[model samples]
Target chain A: MRSDFVRREVATGLRRNVTMTVAMVLTTAISLALLGTGMLAVRTIDSTESLYADRLEIQVALTQDVSAADQDCSQPICSGLKKTLENSPLVESVTFESQQEAYTRFQQLFAGQSIADVARPQSLPATLRVKLADQQTGADAVRQAMNGQVGVRTIIDQRDVVGKLFDFLGGVRNVTFALALVQAVAALLLISNTVQVSAYTRRVEVGVMRLVGATRWYTQLPFLIEAVLTGVVGAVLAGVGLVVAKFAFIDDLLAGIAQNGVIPPITIYDVLETSIWLLPIGAAIAGVTGYVTLRLYVKV
Target chain B: MVAMATVATHEGSSLPLTLGDGRGGIRERSPRRAEGAGRTRVAGAAPGTVPTVIRLERVTKMYKTSTRPALDRVSVSVDKGEFVFLIGPSGSGKSTFLRLLLREDVPTRGRITVADLDVAKLPRRRVPRLRQRIGVVFQDFRLLPNRTVGGNVAFALEVIGKPQATIARVVPEVLELVGLEGKADRMPHELSGGEQQRVAIARAFVNRPLVLLADEPTGNLDPDTSQDIMLLLERINRTGTTVVMATHDHSIVDSMRRRVVELDLGQVVRDESRGVYGVGR
Candidate 1:
């Protein structure tokens, strides 16, 4: 292979079709960026799920009468209910929150909301917060054991609340992937068209080269290199875009949620990890598309 | 006519005929033929005869859309260091005959050989190697528009992976041989039609190929200029390169008094040694 000749040919081809090359690069970059974002979201969802699992617990609220009478879970009804929960095989540990403590937590949760002001110390119910050894099956076991028991009002699984957040994140991932897929199709079309046009413009010279005994691969390698060069540039731009989004967009937008620990933050490390694969992926897509297009549409 | 005679005289004096020792020089460059000469013998020929460079035995070509074949059972043989002109009117299969020799279009039936390699049996991967041994020229003088004359000629060697030093050396020599020594820096568009054709010839001859196939090389040139190009080709032929040119130019065939193979309706109607363009002309 003549590296110098190929280099010159690729440079000439890209320069000649500047508009098409730029369009292809930008389209590929956007699609790869969206793909990388979707992958990062998946990673975030996985981490957030494991984090919630470690802290997952089932909350059993006491009846108003039991809350007013117990004061400290010393009453037989409240104390016996707590003892039953702690003795269950599914329950890892059971902690009691008195009415006053429950009222304080309620105010903290609804802080800056009018509901926090409306809540009073006696109005809130005391609860037994039950931790489990295994989150998947322990919730059902605890619910069955505590159903219709004295002093129990309602049982709430924390997983149900977390499940809602996961569903929303999953929807976001789906949307990103859908958009990425559309952009990918556009990119493929643009790449093939660019290769065709490039080959067409240089058809005369390529014909002469072939007559002069150049192999088909020799005649076609310049166009393939042009596609791959654009793909690499697009991948680099996408990596830069991801890094910039992480710093300038995602970080500020998710700051409040990240601070509250509801979801994991999009870290620079994750962006780099996901962006790293985009280079090779971009090159492969462009290379293969260029090759098939040449074989099918352009004789060169 | 006076100008044509003067150009002919000038052509004779300008070229040195460096390799004019004839078949020995061309045969020395091709060792594969020497080794395989005994294995594949041309039929009806005496043993130990000089191997033919280009051969076609009952060759036929049929295009899918056309009712009749483009070339029909055409058989011809060209020996080493011979100049053969294919002459006929339009649709006489002149182009198809040249194309088949170049392997641009394969024969629907029959056998063809060039430089001892069977044209149809050669693998696609080795097609380039076959072409490298045979240089081709078109009437359009398909020079790279963007490249200067030197670059256009150099491109042929460059694509075939010839070293830069070799290209730097041979490009000037071939350019000089074709009488374009000082016009190397001029672009194709900047030169006249004759000069442009000369550049094309230089490119084809740069590799010193065993066979040179020219399709209407002077088709676009004036009568006076065409004579000059023809004389240049005649000079190159003296250097032991087998030249096969397809043309409709009668004056050239009649004036050169060379071997002529005339075709009509895809069949060889006349094969004459030292013949004119037409019978009794």
Candidate 2:
């Protein structure tokens, strides 16, 4: 029939079923909030790993010296060799270390310990520190290229720590996605059930409209609009809830981490970006649920 | 005025002439000429002013049931602007005959047309539109209980998607015609039986239908109220709406002295002009 009549009918339906409508909105909002929080958590893990990867460095350690014929060498010999290696194509920079320098670094690391009583300094190995283009490729290549160098015993790549950190973050991301999916499914069930009941309650009016030559679209349009409204409100609530949680828990935890110099802090921009995308996703979920449920249960 | 007078005529037999009231008399004259010579009227002579708007041609309705048809090869036609009565006992298919005009039940054998719309093979979607052209008053009044008298009347136009302004304008006029102007805001349950039927009549006539077919319209009313409804229907018929009333109310039919088509066992037993309810009455 007329658009004005359809609008009036929809308004009447909403007014008559106010309690159910609010319940539907609240359930949708809660479920979407859970989903948004999970998504933001995954995003935080990704950003943290990216920041860690960008700043982290790989350090290579050279073992005890050997002579060219017998591979034996002094700290002076290794230092001169380190300078020669620094000029190579693969190496970005190289710093030489003597036994005395190693002893001084150990004393700084364990400051209050009686190092003279517990240990002697004459047994330390002098080495060259090497920085490469990248930890995985350039540092590995450097270690391989230096395998047969004179007075070199072994090379140690420090990228093992970076590998372990990435593995942890990957596990976190997978768990986060799984939780998000569960929340989304729950939202779908709740919203679809609510819409189905709404259609059922209005079934007599639907029947009369059908008899009066109303097409299927006209009969279902109001419910579809209601579903859209629910979706929009739910999504906004979800995004807001995430913003609050991000500030309450995540920011405080990151702040504590930054004080200890363990890591830099996360930002609200990251959370906002992730949560904003959830709005459309929420609306889509509501629309699909409304369309499918009405198709199956209500006909014009 | 009809009086019983016996006189000798040219056929060497005595004929009876009953003369009585101006509204109640029997006049039968047999043609002296040959049959079928003047039976069919020539074209362009105003189409013989009978008050029947519906015509059925060898109509037969055979449902998916037993051996016999529901309406077996029935051929009857009604003229325009006439208050015709269809009288029958139970199982005589009086309801079926009423349904045929509304196209609720289509004939299986031949064509049936109402208001010049060939209703025999009319499409299903056009049924409601066709119904809008014919006002049907049911015995139950069939008023929506939730609606006011005015709302019920406006619903007839509303279903056909008439604009609100038109509905607002026409509903009050129809309600005034039905003498229910003061009861426009009252629900159906709040009105008396006569008033409720008037509301229904107003609903049916709001769009000025071509024919008014009432299936036992006064069945639920008292005798006085039934006469009032009949009077309303007669008034509507005076304005050129062909009115067909199906009823078993002997008193109402006997008093009207209108054209009566009497049916017995799904077949017309008598087709009499100005027929009475019973010979004794």
Candidate 3:
């Protein structure tokens, strides 16, 4: 068939069923946008993992009775504890955080909050942050050895905290995927309905083509192409939606908290990568849904 | 995806189908599978001469729900460039016979060949190529409602992948041939019943099909307008395209004095060359 004629037919068919076509496009766009968010959530989880993978800091807080009088460690027990950590092969390195250092860090970490103004140098306790060299087994050995040490207070396992972070990210991913699933179903149904209505309205035209010996493919080509075309348009719309969302919402939230370094910011690249991933998925979802529906539902 | 793509290639498949006899009995046959099997000449053909356009041998079609056969042991053939009329009552199997020709339905028993292709065996995908060689006219003209008369005619070529230049050149010639030259821009609803039928006939003949089938082409028109439509069909026939028209217009058949094949109760009761209508009466 002449390509111009096919284009004309596609345009005419789309125009003939404007309401259904619009609904199909909108549903496809929404579904793809949700899918993009899901993909980005997965990427964010990956980024968070890489950022914290080797940075699990094990903070050992000093008890008040052991060093309440002075920030300097002239006491034999404190110096002995420091030497024990230095001599241990499991500990990658140990850095002492003084009462003054902890207070300054706290003030900087909570600068925007009211509690930072009241915090003083003597109010915070000093501690050693242990970075395990052989993270797979060293952290367990150090925690076991340090559990009942003299002048020691409490051992804080950063790995457990990071595990909580991963759990939260995993929850976000699950929610995103669940919402995407619902939207995908909606998109598929809308696409099928659109094709069915288009086929029904053009029944006369299809019958004539069949009588004239046009192939089932030939008679059905315009509708299929229209379906694929609608899907691509929806994908582009979803890509745009992702970009706007990253700039208007995610970027703003990250900028506010990014200064304190509380959480690693998800870059625009994540949004772009999600959009890039969504284009083919969006097209595939629409195109495959259309083909299957035509095969099973529409006789032509 | 592979199956759908195979439809585009349209190579024959060895799909085993259930065969049945005329008396409402079913049987299985390990029928010939003609995939990559060279095109056998339409049954009973000598090469180089004008081929047999349509052939049906012992064909039977019995609807599953119906007690009696729709077409029982019916066999007929039309050579290239012949004009034949099918006459029958409402349930006398006229439409069923035409539908079989179109491969819209298959025969329960025996074989049907159109343009030398075993229509009963023709894969569903290749039906369009068979139909491209045949044109059909109906009682109610099936023109696309929005398109102008020229677009309706050009539509046949468009579906078959004809180029624009060819469509541009041929559409006007066909419109002129159908004597709707000036009304090329008019839509189907804008034209009268006869004019709409003319547009339909124009579309059918635009591709210059080897055979034309009309199912009550004049069923809706008045006598005088019906006479005009018949004249157009007769003119089409004179151009060496075989015409097979099914109609209950006894008066028109009588006036034409052409070959008439009459059907009664799913069987061909009368076939005469250059015979008038109701000659059996």
Q: Which stretches of candidate 1 lie above 4 Å from their native place?
A: A65-91, A143-152, B1-48
Provide the lowest-lDDT 10-residue window in model 1 chain B: B20-29
Worst 10 residues of 2 chain A by lDDT: A65-74
In terms of TM-score, which candidate is strongest? 1
Give one digit per residue, the lDDT tens place, for model 2 in A183-219. 6677777777777777777765554444333445566
State candidate 2's TM-score: 0.58
Model 1: per-residue lDDT, tens digit, A208-244?
8778889977899999999988888999999999999
Q: State the TM-score of candidate 3 restricted to chain B.
A: 0.82
TM-scores of the models, in the order given: 0.86, 0.58, 0.82
Per-candidate DockQ vs. reference = 0.59, 0.11, 0.56
Candidate 3 — which residues are off by over 4 angstroms?
Answer: A60-91, A96-104, A107-128, A133-153, B1-50, B269-279
Better of 1 and 3 by TM-score: 1
Indicate which candidate wins on lDDT. Answer: 1
Report the lDDT of model 2 for residue A267: 64
Residues B1-281, candidate 3, lDDT per residue (tens digit)? Answer: 22322232232322222222232221111112111111332332332344678888888899999989998887676666667889989999999999999888999997999887899999888888889889999999889988999989988888888888899999999889988999999988999999999999999999998889999999999999999999899788867678999999989888775556666788766554444566533
